[model samples]
Target: MNETLIRWLEEREIADVRSRNLELAKAFAMVVKSTDQVFDLGCGTMSNFRYLDPLLSMNQNWIGVDHDPGMLRRSEPLVPRTRVQLREMNLATGVRTLPQGPGCAFTASAFLDLVSKEWIDQFAAHCKDSPILIAMSTAGQPEWSPIHELDEPIRLRIKSHQNSDHGFGPSLGADAACYLVDQLRHYGCRVIVRETNWILDSRDGTLLSMMIDGIERRVQSVQDPVDAQVWADRRRLELLKAELRLTVRHLDLLSIP
Candidate 1:
């Protein structure tokens, strides 16, 4: 969530660039159906604008919110200042600053994995009174990876790797993915969920590298030097291995109610 982790996301997710983009596109397509307008939460670097650009070009209104001013500043040039409105907000803190009324929906890609259930429940409550849709939530956890066949050590290691990320939000928000499905339905959204699988073997090193580097940086901030070193060495080995098949199972929450 820090700039340091953001840098890691940028660096290591190179290989997953296409796949991740595709997933976002699929989510956007399902949500808005027609791109009249959208509200993007945690609009980091506003990079998501370009990914969903096909929708943007329809002259749809875009309102992006993020806590990082640096990301908002970087995203300003992508659209006419009028068409795109970027604000500073933290959804976990609250979305009272989010624009009111309906016909527009909320969206987030790979974002559910970063906030707590308290945030999700509060966000759902915000939309309960309107025809607002919580367009997309891509949670890449509780997945079935091809590496299921690998020895237990690596698998356990990968699980341990995920341990830190659990604190990020909903342990990838898989349960929230389910909870949102129900909540959105109650909000009158015609809700459904789609599971997406992305395979990461040795051949796809970009995201692997990013995950490793990001974890390393996070570990460095702690006081447990010995524990950090051990984690660092294991992740380094995984990073070098070209054939690590990590399957990403992500959920697409559809809200049409």
Candidate 2:
């Protein structure tokens, strides 16, 4: 992940707290027992661990896996090193390489949208016996409180960008969660999905700004440069005036096999 993107995720934790489905999290926690081991894929800076550790009562061991060594190194200070182990692994190859055992749970946050349908199927196949929680995937719906004429066009462009290959094959983007649910169920797992949207306003200015930048960048890649810049300028003006509020729709999925 980009460093700026990682920082944006860190900043957006507050919004995630408000948007995440607590009931689902509690349900997942109930399924976990003491001394269980949880593996977090694309763990990045370990924000998923930060959000879940307190909710789970088990004296569980956590393995944070990421392809980026820098991310793993950066997460060291934030996580309890004794109970949390950070490993370097490339999820792009497949999830089969992840450590496996009984009483293990698999998790990832804000990650599935970047993977392909094939990758998710492989993930389900490998973890057929483990309970899984995948959170905060983009749902291809973005709403601006004070609507802009360019909003829909921009959104479409961003969605297109989302589906672009991210090393694993064509990304499933917004369709990832639903695909995972179906694939996991095919593998005989029970799955539940819930919405987890980020509601951003002036109070979340930093994250809001970062989101605009990201959207604009994605749009630029797919549209004429001049048109993209104009759209971005209009959005940035609203952002500068503190006149914009954004709702970024995402989905969270839980699977028990």
All candidates: CA RMSD (Å):
4.8, 1.8
- Per-candidate TM-scores read 0.71, 0.93
Per-prediction count of colliding residue pairs? 10, 0
lDDT of 2 by residue, 148-193 (tens): 7788777777777789898889999999999888898997888999
Best by lDDT: 2
Alpha-carbon runs more than 4 Å astray in model 2:
223-226
The 10-residue segment with the lowest total lDDT in model 1: 142-151
The whole-model lDDT of each prediction reads 0.56, 0.84
True lDDT of residue 5, candidate 1: 53
- In candidate 1, residue 201 scores what lDDT? 64
